[model samples]
Target: MTHLKVGDKAPDFSALDEQGNRVSLSDYKGKKLVVFFYPKASTPGCTAEACNLNDNYQRFQSLGYEIIGVSADSAKRQANFKTKYGFQYPLLADEDKAVIEAFGVWGPKKFMGKEYDGIHRTTFIIDENAVITDVISKVKTKAHSEQILGD
Candidate 1:
């Protein structure tokens, strides 16, 4: 699948949240969205990214944006991560990689000279109408929320 570009309609998906509650992309219609795809739950980079978003979550809400994190982690892992970090947003469990693949975030990756398929740290800013406004591909985990909010 091609990487989604600005002006592309954000792909709609439904997934289970950390608490096993159903979440759908369409559920947030008429609100801007920050749909972030990370490699795993509780990993250093992922945690940093998630925490950055959590820290600035109120600001995001003030700006009329709903934040969501997605990964191939199980619901239990996502629940633990959210509780440990006190995250206010939902972390969707994409254990089947369906949502990740639809967003073009699941692909080959290399670490320590070993190539494997995994989620690429990426963020999509979608408008109220579901059109993607920006694609943040090379995300800096520590300053992620700042970058997303254009700080």
Candidate 2:
């Protein structure tokens, strides 16, 4: 969904989290970041993906990486999803697609033979310097952490 690749400078973005608190790329300055873009909150695939990350949250943290999930869901929806799943990371409510567009994950997708515009399930692993080190375009929802950590 995105043309971005490893070694590309990650684009900066600012958006609201589930609590309406502002979140920006700058907040993660000096830390590695894992920014995963999903289509929605609370859906089966999305839940599996998020839970996978949550289950392995500490591993990423131990490796000096902070994870953030982004979707076009409303703040209320994001909050509910986080609360329901006990996610260890904040879910960004990018209702306006600012962060989504900035990352180039908002585009057409096909599922069950139906085509529609939505956020692509892509994950970008950015270094502390804000340069992308890996771009996971074909995300494996249930085993995403292993995919990211390569373990």
Candidate 3:
């Protein structure tokens, strides 16, 4: 679970995108941003969530929202995932977990009765001024766009 809340200030971060481009929070200073963190790239749940968002990319854009995906995957893996899905937004390759940790999404997780540490899937909706407006901890992968859109 995330320590960040709806009214909290989004933590600043700088990381390399799939294309190895340096991206930072400041880059989106004047735009609404959807920063979603997933446990890994190319996984079933992650794929569904990402694709759902991409499928409604135009809707989000028309509503003045820019989306970005993040995971602890490498640059090559992130690139492959983006290319495979034809995602219109950038996917950050947070190999070092810098951005992940900064957002407090990296923590203990359990799967199939096994305990381990991993990135917890989470999403943050940020306004143009960089304040978090919503935090979705229980993400619904297939209907994620609706979750974000409140539809």
Best by TM-score: 3
RMSD of each: 1.0, 0.7, 0.6
Candidate 1 residue pairs in backbone clash? none
TM per prediction:
0.97, 0.98, 0.98
Stretches of candidate 3 above 4 Å error? Answer: none
Model 1 C-alpha lDDT versus the unseen true structure = 0.93
TM-score of candidate 3 relative to the true fold? 0.98
Give the 10-residue window scoring lowest on summed lDDT in candidate 1.
1-10
Q: Write the per-residue lDDT of candidate 1 for residues 1-151, one digit (tens) a residue.
A: 2379999999999999999999998999999999999988999999999999999999999999999999999999999999999999999999998899899988788999999988888999999999999999989999998898888
Error of 1 at 62 (Å): 0.5
The deviation in Å at residue 76 for candidate 1 is 0.5
Which scores better on TM-score, 2 or 3?
Answer: 3
What candidate 2 gets wrong by more than 4 Å, as runs, is none
| Per-residue C-alpha lDDT of model 2 across residues 4-51, encoded as one tens digit per residue | 988999999999999989999999999999999999899999999999
Model 3: which ten-residue window has the lowest total lDDT?
1-10
